[model samples]
Target: VLKGVVYISLSDNMLYKSGSYEMSDQAGETLNKIAKIIKDYSNYDVLIEGNTDNVPITSKNIRNNWDLSALRASSVVQTLQNKYGVDPKRLTAGGRGEYNPIADNSTEAGKIKNRRTQIIITPKLDQFMDLIGKAPEKS
Candidate 1:
């Protein structure tokens, strides 16, 4: 059996429009499949993280990559709760912006790869509390 958290990562291009945070229809379909999986494993909490390329973004709606990323993450969480019936308490949304890059941002291909979203499903740790018992005090 898996011991701890299981993370599911999805790219932003697959979920949203370029320079936008709205979830696309295709994203809905993909999220539906994910929702089914979450339903079966309802004991876990989900953390939706949004990441963006280093390219600067400026718009009336968005202040920067951070705002854009955060909104994207929030949008995913909202979709999971509103459309998929997932409990709101089990969801968290965070934006990493252009800071954490998985690829070289010098190339278009790399930038595309960097703009992404990650869904991390962490199993509740309460089940192991008994095993851990109490920690010894520091010296």
Candidate 2:
């Protein structure tokens, strides 16, 4: 957890097969556990962010890392809503592609680290918005 937000990073290998957005059976089990936690925390919103290594990719369906990343995130979000019964309004899906690298992409280990899906859970914005509304304006 960081700054009141919980970050759960799942490696690409855990969620998908090589170069594909299709979630594995193991991914379903993992997501089932995550869904339980999400249900336990009703006031938090989930952000599914997908990241990829710097390696270029071209497949029958996926054109590039950006497309792959977005598709991966969307897959997770859809599963969470449709399969796990998470509220659709509480989820957001995004792709970082190769831009936001937590590790150097020059090494195999780094590339492995770069290929990940981050599930960021944060409290809803209602309290924050209320705080902002109550703040006094300066001249």
Candidate 3:
């Protein structure tokens, strides 16, 4: 296909242990699948976005859900780069916390659904050969 992209939704139940950013074994496997997609679609960019429930983190340093989400996203980005040889430059790590919840936060199930880490793979705009002539030069 011409436009290659992979968007995978990792539910909160499939994530790392509570209060940690390390992915579970199954989550690691999912990350592996993501890595393979990156390797398969050469010249691609990966966006690792972390999301969290409306609940706040009472941990010592994790003052808010934002910290938790951001850290999780960073952790995933590190995993892809360190374990899978994915170029660091091609990866973007970010977090939406409870701001971009995909589900309601009023119930346990909804909160669980609200928490997630989305791995989005897409062709890098600047690296696309086909877009070479379509894009305006920087200078």
Count of steric clashes across candidates, in order = 0, 0, 0
The CA-based lDDT of model 2 is what?
Answer: 0.91
How many times do residue backbones clash in model 1? Answer: 0
TM-score of each: 0.87, 0.90, 0.83
Shift of residue 96 alpha carbon in model 1, Å:
0.5
Write down the worst ten-residue block by lDDT for model 1: 127-136
Compose the digit string of candidate 1's lDDT tens values, residues 67-106: 9999999999999999999998989999999999999999
Worst 10 residues of 3 by lDDT: 1-10
List where candidate 1 sits over 4 angstroms from the true fold: 1-3, 128-139
Each prediction's RMSD over C-alphas, in Å, is 3.6, 3.1, 4.5
Clashing residue pairs for model 3: none
lDDT of 1 at 9: 74
True-vs-predicted CA distance for residue 30, candidate 3, Å: 2.0
State, as a TM-score between 0 and 1, how close model 1 is to the true structure: 0.87
